[model samples]
Target: MKTQDIFVLGLTTFALFLGAGNLIFPPAMGLDAGTSLTSAMAGFLITAVGLPAFTIIVLGRIGNTNNLTKALPKWLGTTFWVLLFTAIGPAFGMPRAVTVAYEMGIQPFFTNDHLVAFSIIFSAVTLFLAFKPGNLVTYIGKIMTPALIILLCGLGLAAFLSPLGTPAAPSGDYQVGAVTSGLIQGYMTMDAIAAVGFGWVIIHAIKAKGVTTQQGIASTSIKVALIYAALMASCYIVMGYVGATSTSIAEHGVNGSVILTRYVAGEFGHYGQWLLAAIILMACLTTTVGLTNACAEYYQDTFKASFGFTATVIVVLTGVIANFGLNDILKVSLPAILVLCPVAIALVLASLAASTFTVSRLTHSAVLITATLFGTIDAINILGKMPKDLGDFFSDTLPLYNAHAGWLLPSLFMLITTAMIGRTASAEKKFGRVDYRLKTANND
Candidate 1:
């Protein structure tokens, strides 16, 4: 990739990653984390940037998403990816975008009447983008990102001119779990899901600026990711700092977007309000477009729907769903995230755990079995009714589980154990070494 290719790809990747969720989640987590912002930021970066970049770079290296997805056992890998992105888009994400757009973008105009009208307006704008899906990265680069930057700059400057007093330390035991909360909040951002799809988008961005060959594209994407991630990390650091310090917005237990707008306004007056409105609108629009386009592409591949029709249907459906309201979206979304996040983390991070291990199919199978079983139980325990004794037993007596994630520890143990055994078996059969089962799948 040439110099311009790297620059454009980096900007495109940044556009892909930034969103209203990104802005909203980090601040709230920071607000609660207080003095723990450093640790929380570390955890957030691991999941938000590290894991996401891992997903995209790995996919770029592989060069074929279908093969990458298909390489996993029983088709679980792709299904997990699909379900995650779908949830991030239609189920929770789009609606959040709608309401956020209403609060931050449209509220300034109507002040009273805007909420109802803005919901419809936000959905309509999203619908237009979804209907006219194009090369997503390029489209954002050409239009959406410039608008986003102007707005962000205005807000940042406004915040600089007038400041909210540093916030107080977190209340109660929640302070102890700030790192864990940041990790969980990272899941809500859906960066891992974006990681799966944006690799191709990154490649396209690179190639458009003139990159060719899988190796070249992969190398360039990594460079771009590194640069983009650093900038994003800086943004998180600043926002986290702001949230940690700011005391102007009284804790109403309101939504993050509401908190953000009120905080800005209290600090910088009406100018901050106007600037934030533009930022939210632009970010939401870019996110909505990128997500809808990705959904269209995946579905077209799966069901033979023409790209145009598939994209249109996704936009309209999600837009209509936005009428449901932001707070309502948050309720169901949190439950779903608790279900999907661990599995997504497992799948993406397994490649990193033993990067040299090449047992493609067996590794995928083992991780899927371990994670899915555990994730389901974890979700059920958290979100659904289960017998008291049964829950306690699983939480306490299970090999490597807890009330929170009875699946996580056990699942990890299971995958590593299975992979080692499979490796031994493979090695023994091939080299007449030992008859250890690890030889079977370990080499992979």
Candidate 2:
């Protein structure tokens, strides 16, 4: 594809990935990282930026998510598919998108009384667009995404030209393990799952451009990913800078949205608030539409449900839950994220290296099992689902447990061991001496 076409494709991918959480998480993380902001951001970029980029490329290479899941057993794959769509759909991500759009966008313009009304209208538009998924590239990518970028760039530039204040001292886990804590925070975004959920849109967009071959898709995806990575990195840096500097002016313990709201007001005065709100509104709208469409497509494909039925289910569920607001939804979301992200990451990594490592179904299963096992422990700890003693045991036993990446080593071990076993078994079947006595007996 030409550069212009590639840019348009990149915009859709970027908009889909750069949702409410993308806006919310980085700034708060920077505040927490404080003096360790650089190190923390580096780690954050690994998963927050890295995993999502990897996911899109992997999906592009593999053709679609259905093909990607072929690495796992049938039942497990089905379960994962269902869980992934739900987690990123109305159950969690879509609601966050709705709430964030309201809290950051329309809420500032209106009183609390209008929240219900705003949410209904927002979800109604989202549902309408979701039902017409094919035109998303044009609606979001060509129109809203460009506007979002322009507003964000203006805000970031203004912030950089004049920072809030010097960053405060590192606090909490950041004082000791800033990078690790950042990685944990990145994992918390659960964007790896979002990438998977939203990626099909990009794949379809690419195919629409008439690039059908695997190599063609993968190469085009790289260009698209580079654009996405650059945009995300730049935005994160600017947002983190804003948050880090706000330590002096803003109260401690405020969320990113509040910090950003205050900072924009401080920077550009009344008009800045509207500008920031517009940026957030566009961001959330793009994400909400993408996720709703993805959810509808998933259900329609998997269960043969009508697109309108699935879209209704998604929009209605999201609308109802969004009224609960961001914090309450986050309380439910974080644990599920902790459980799902590791498995998704492991699957992506294993698939990427499948040819080189001789990764088999067994390998994928073992890795996912190990990841899910530790991931559950992490989730349980987060939710306080297990006894203190059990949580303590898990934390103490696992390396990098405190980093929220304790699942990494065990999953890697399982992947390697299973791959070796699979390779050896394949070798035996292919090259080992035949059982001549059994062959002769069968002939007799």
Best by lDDT: 2
Best by TM-score: 2
Evaluate all candidate structures by whole-model CA lDDT and list the values in order.
0.67, 0.82
Candidate 2 structure quality by residue, lDDT tens digits, 1-444: 778989987888888888867887878888877778999998888878888988988877777667767878789898988888888887888888887787778777775557788889999988887788778888887888889889988988888899878888888888988888888787777788788887767887788788988889889988898889888888888888888888766765779988888888899999988988888888888888988888787778778999898889889999999887768877877777778888988887777767455655677787888899988877776666778787788777888776667788998888788877878887777664466656877999
List clash counts for every candidate, in order. 26, 0
Encode model 1's per-residue lDDT on 1-444: one tens digit a residue: 567656655766777678777887777766777777787788788767777777777765655455444657535665766787678777776666776677667766763565556666666676666565445555676567766766666556655566576657775433787666666566546677666665545654566666678778668767887877876786677667667656567462446666677777776677768777777778777777777767776777666789787766666667667776667765767666666766765665555444447453466567766777777777777665667888877866775343255666766776677668767877766776454555766876
Superposition TM-score, candidate 1 onto the true structure: 0.83
lDDT of 1 at 166: 65
